[model samples]
Target: MIHNKKEFNLGIALLVLFFIVLFAMFQPLFDGHNAMAYLDNLYNSISKGSAHYVDALKEEAKTLAGYNVKVTMNMEDEAQAADSVALITAAGGTASAQGKALTINGDYVAILNACLNDADKLYNNDSAALKAKYPALAGKDDRQAVYNWYKILGGFDKELKKQEAFAQAKVAFNVNSKVVETAYNYYKVVPEQIKNKIGIVIFSLVFYVIYTMWYGFAILFVFEGWGLKISGH
Candidate 1:
């Protein structure tokens, strides 16, 4: 028994329209992608746009030029150590592998420049250039090359810090975290400015907040009109 027929009917109408809109949201109406996917990509692109720190890292590396560094880092395996040797030598640094222990000795800038170059290529989706530059990475995934760089640079950072080479360590840390890691994770994502998509960005955020509240109110209206309430006995 509905205590208030008009309120109950209004609630029913609101719920009916709510479900209709919800069904439409699941359809591929936004440039061949559903509403959720479109919004997800939009946010990801915005994030990737601001996450590029490769160029800045390049500038910072210049400060460390002629700063020779010597650090020996342990690798996961002999193959990784061998790969590290190839990478370091290609960067104009002398490197040797003895079992799983790899040693690097050279100017810090030379090593860092090579890392920034690789990061820039991956960030720009130029795996072809990266592979071409390092034939050692031929017949294999280019991203694996970047991952090897990441591991090598990370090892360099730890060894530098332990030796109190803080300036060199800081640069290495930024290269691995800001440049290499970001490039790897956001590979192939086309970045976009939030200002360019301001309209939809604002609309989606507002709609998501209001829509859920609207549903709650509709349910409350229905229950109240149907004579459901707390009472003191």
Candidate 2:
């Protein structure tokens, strides 16, 4: 009986230690009373930044379109006819460039939507829905599904940054032109802080799972050890 009591006390102590370690590991996730708040903030930042960037591109396109119309309307002015024609041609090229930017932005938005959808599915623990929605992930298990979703999000952010850099470079090369300069000035990229936050969010997500698994195994060990002690007694 004394041995059994000692074993039970040890089990309780082990369980307490397990919880302490688990809590320490997941402290970041527990902040603000929302385990996934960092992830949500990261997603929101990306979505809002991308939307604003796309809108700015559209506005730049509209500006060039207007310039094209103006140049065309003033083509009859003999003194400025050559200059007008040149401006019109430049405007057409700039407008085409902006259109391409918009197309790229659309692609980014699509990827972002997929990321958000996957996140929702993960949050709801709807593994079946995730598999159904993403046929490529149909065969993956639950943990794998979560990892794949995270990978997709990380890839999307990387691609978005690359595309943004390319767009910015395009605008910079044409900075001598007023319209291009205006577009360049209006270009908004994801902030560095948000990018760092994404890393933190991903880390927290992965650690959350790891810590939970550890805690479960610790509990199992404690119970098994206590059972052995009781049988011995």
Candidate 3:
């Protein structure tokens, strides 16, 4: 029941070409990576490139110099407690662990710098060095150590708020959010500037829009050629 043979034939041709392009996209065409996966990695690298603010954060931390804060962080277990103690002592802070409780007293800035240093190492994908420094973490995933940092810092933030040392607590929150979280999530991703991949990035976006429309138009042409129409009654 074709009303226009030429239009329906044109639609079939376009629809066939669309499937061909889609099938090609799913192939290992770009350096053995499918187009979507390559683009996903490209965007992730670009974002990680600009997301490094640890150095700047370290500098800002120095402004909290001379501020002494004390908090007893409650950890999940003795193993985690021992790990926290190591991190605190490395930052030149005094930490004593009893059972699962870790008492910390130190210049918040110095301690913050230590956390940043560890995060920087992870961000650069130098997990071997991080594991080497912490003997307890040997043969274990390095992210476990970073997660300890996250938990310990979260403890610091909550305890500081209780003592009404809001400024110092704010510092903890910022570092946890900005540096520690980013490093943990983007682990092993080599960052690069988006401008370098501008050509491919733009091409992908444009192709996405055009290809979507191509499918829609093909459907519309086919329906119209079959004398189908929407009308206001």
The all-Cα superposition gives candidate 3 an RMSD in Å to the true structure of 1.5
Residue 98 accuracy (lDDT) in model 3: 96
Please report, in order, the local distance difference test score of every candidate based on alpha carbons. Answer: 0.88, 0.40, 0.88
lDDT of 3 by residue, 37-106 (tens): 8788889999998899998888788888899879998999998888778888888999998999989999
Number of the top lDDT candidate: 3
lDDT of 3: 0.88
Task: Answer with 1 or 3, whichever has the higher lDDT.
Answer: 3
The TM-score values for the models, in the order shown, are 0.91, 0.30, 0.94
The predicted structure with the larger TM-score, 1 or 3, is: 3
Clashes of each: 0, 0, 0
- Write one digit per residue (lDDT tens) for candidate 1, span 125-212: 8999888877877888768678888988889889999999899899999999999998899888887888998999899989998999
Would you list the clashing residue pairs of candidate 1? none
**Clash pairs detected, candidate 2:** none
The model with the greater lDDT, 2 or 3, is: 3
Residue 58's lDDT within candidate 1 is 91
Q: What RMSD, rounded to one decimal, does every model reach?
A: 1.9, 18.0, 1.5
